[model samples]
Target: MLLLQANNVERRFGADILFHNVNMQIDEHSRTALVGRNGAGKTTLLKMIAGITEPDEGTISKAHDLSIGYLAQDQGLDSQNNIWDELDSVFAPLHEMEKSIHQLEEKLSSIDSTTDEYQYIIQQYDHLQTTFKEQGGFEYASKMRGVLTGFGFGEDMYDLPINSLSGGQKTKLALAKILLQEPQLLILDEPTNHLDMNVLNWLEDYLRGYNGSVLVVSHDRYFLDHVVSQVYDLDNQTLTHYTGNYSAFTKEKADWLRAEMKHYDQQQKKIAKLEDFVNKNLVRASTTKRAQARRKQLEKMDRMERPTTDDSSIHFSFHSDKDSGNEVLDVENLKVGYNENVLAGPLSFKERKGQRIGIIGPNGIGKSTLLKTILKKQPAISGSIKLGANLEIGYYDQEQQQLHPDKTVLDEVWDDHPEVPETEIRSLLGSFLFVGDDVFKTVKELSGGQKARLELTKLSFQPINFLILDEPTNHLDIDSREVLETAINEFTGTVLFVSHDRYFLNQVATDILNMSSTGITHYQGNYDDFVNETSTLSQNEDKTTIPSTTQTSSKKSAGQQSYQASKQNQRARRKIQREVDKFEQEMDSLQAKHDQIEQQMSAPEVATDIAKLSDLQKQLDECQQQLDQAEENWTDAAERLEEFDQE
Candidate 1:
């Protein structure tokens, strides 16, 4: 069943058309993604669907009483209530029902058992109970708890004032509230922005088990691949649908473009040939009839216009004037922070001239502080850092600290290199997509993404053997991220950068450094490699511990204690494993049933039968509920197992 449809949608900004004749549909239970380069109207299209903005020309059709929850980028909650209260407000209806049930119960106790009032109260109570169960009244609190924990909000922080939370925390809180609302359709714009890897993974699992249709606007390819079943590409003022995930979409789109371009070239050649023949033959009297026939054919034929592709992207490269020594950097027992406080480290590491190291950690663990200390932007709390000879460092600050907001884009670069001519500066800006009049605009007027591009443009011209980038991919679109990855991979200099973009880290990093409040742990390979290695170590630890109960004596030998601890650990693992297996089985059963219902819904007779359709929908809803419960169970079991392993 289709939940929402936009037919012949057209959106315009003043004289400029953002998109025209755009059509899309969201089916019941579908997971769809909207993707495009920055400023391609993807967000605009989403807004139109969400009823936050109206299309200039088109009609949006939705199921009757279709509930929708839309989460836009930077959408924060405004509340005087604490975190738990804010989230609990989503169940106001259920709370009302609970109150009515209680009131009836009180009235029933005062009336005689045989009285009509008592019987009436009993019926009301029964009805309320049925409604409450159907509405998930009993499970609402538990579900809210799960969402809170998944987003890294623990019980200790549940009482914190909503207004007191950080921007990222507020965003997470907003998302958690939306999840609890359980609308029929969920529209999320850049939902992955503030999430760490752990939260991101949890969200993927959560959304997969969601009962509603989801249409999301995002640049996170990894998240899209994991959650969305279909992709919608918005490019050149049009939208095209792909059947699979991001990776599959890429391959399919490439093949389609190749075929489309080839057919267009062939058509153009044929037209040219016909025109030439007609021109050569028209002058001769004997061939005049043939020429006229050719002309008539040309006039009658429908012309095919050449297809255009989007190519508005930054194009630039990084370079070094001189090579650094083999050992580019050495840090021993380094601690970085402000004042006397240490945010992270008591750490040590070495970076070679050609190594690309990626630093990653939870929010506010001092990844950026570490970078500032290395570049001498801030004082190190303790220890030492040594830079190799002939080394020049270029830094890309996530905050764009070096940019002069009052300076024009042209002057921002030119001021740094006065010897470079104005024309050359304009050309460089053009490569970064700041063309013509754009260069005359002040840096303060630029968007976050535009500012990032300007920063990269400046970084590109600098002569440096070592690069230190702090969350460089933060404001970039997917295409820009890929371009940056390519540039980093091709550059001969060493790179040490902090990013939450796992895909970027997987592509460019030769090594990974995991940072925390305690210290830093170095890994030999990329993000995936680090995860695998850590998992293996955790598994080994879990397997090696013995149960304490196995020790017979009150005072046991050291070897006996170790064996007993191992046995206890093994028993705990078995318990978690059993729970995991059970939930997995339940999930499989629900999926199979869901698929069967879909097949049944598509049948000719079932499609026409309203009663049958309604029945199937009810079945689907039940299946979704079971699937959701199964997923929650599995997540709890897995997290517990991980905690045990860590211990």
Candidate 2:
């Protein structure tokens, strides 16, 4: 059954068409994602589907009596009620029914046993009781509590008034209320914007098991990959559907572009050949009839227009003047926060050259604070930081605090690199997608994404060997994020950055530093490796020792005992090396099989096969688990190898 459908949707702004011919559907139990670049009218389409706005040239239809819950980005609850009361209000009808039942019970006690009024009241009471039970009135509180707790709100916060809560808390409460309402269709816009990892995990599981249809607009690639099975891409004034997660969509989109380009190229060549024959032979007397025939045929041909591609995205690179020393940075017992409160750490860590370290922690746990203290923008609560020789720092502030609000985009870049010519500076700005009149816009007039691009442009001009970024991916869209990831991956400098984007971390981070008020725990390898190791620790009573740095052997004299220890150490190192190789091979083979299974699942013939889909889903899940374990084993072995080499 179709829950919602938008047909021939056309939206316009003044003379500009935002999007047209946008057709979409959400069937019962469908899990869909709407993805597009920033400014691609995704939010507008979502609003139209939720019935918050009307389309200019199309109709949106929803099933009769269907309920929809829309959670817009930055939408929060405005209420004087406490958290629990606010969430409980979703079951207001149930509460009202319960109240009437009690009233009916009281009236029954007063009425005579033989009266028709008593009989009617008794029937009404029974009806209401049945409705209440059907609506799950008895389980509402427990459901509410489950949602609240999953969103990181505990029992203590339940009594807090909604008006007193922070903006983020209010937003969470709004989502919690929607989940508790259990609408037939759930539409969410940028729902993962302010969520932490724990909340993200919870929401992923919740949505995976959700009974109703879900359509979400989010830039969180990792979240989309996990939750959405189908994706609707809104680009170039149209909508296109892909059958799979974000990664699969990327691969399919690329293949589609290549195929389209090839077809266009072939058609263009044929048209050129026809034109050349007509041009050279039309004037010749001997070939005049043949040329005329060719001309007529060409005129009748339906020429294929070139396939337009949207490429209005930033393109730039990072460069370093020179390499830094072996130990790029060393933080010892570092405590960072304001007002004598240590929000994060008594942390100790060593960052070597060419190591991309990603810092992750919940909001207000001071991930950004750690960056500021290390960059000397703020005073550390305690401890020392050592910067190695020739370490020129480049910092990208997620808040864009380094940019002057009054300065024009052109002046911002030119001011930093005054030695460069004006034309050259403008060229640099254009490379960052600030062309024409856009360069004259004041920094304050630019959007968050624009400011991020400008900041990146400035960073590109600076010759730096070390980068310390704070939430670098905060305002970047998916495309810009991927570009940034590629640039950073190719960068030779050491990086110590804080980010919540798990996808970005997985792409660029070579190590993970989980920060907290208690201390910093360092794990070798990327975000997935960190998760695998940490989760394994929580599951087992005896926590496995995560691989880290090892000290050099102090026994220099060659006694029998020393000799035996050396031999054992060598054997262990070789074993670890072999294990690393084995897991690498296994990971490669599993990934290939994973891709094959996904392809088979998306095949037209197999797509509707329920039993086959279920079996393939089972296989995919198991393959994912095996791949994660293999990666973990590889990380552990690699770390052990490095440790042995260092010793």
Quote the positional error of residue 468 for candidate 2 in Å: 1.0
Alpha-carbon TM-score of each model against the true structure: 0.82, 0.81
* Model 2 residue pairs with clashes: none
List RMSD in Å for every model shown.
21.8, 17.3
Kindly list the per-residue Cα lDDT of model 1 for residues 491-573, writing each as its tens digit: 98999999888778877888999998888989987776776687668656665456663252223335334433544454567
The reply for model 1, stretches above 4 Å from the true place, is: 539-647
TM-score of 1: 0.82
- lDDT for 157 (candidate 1): 96
- Cα lDDT tens digits, model 2, 191-278, are 9877888899889889988989999999898888778889999989999999988876876787788788899899888889989999
lDDT, residue 490, model 1: 71
Compared with the true structure, all predictions reach lDDT values of 0.87, 0.87
Model 2: how far is 297 from its true place, Å? 3.0
Model 2 TM-score, 2 decimals: 0.81
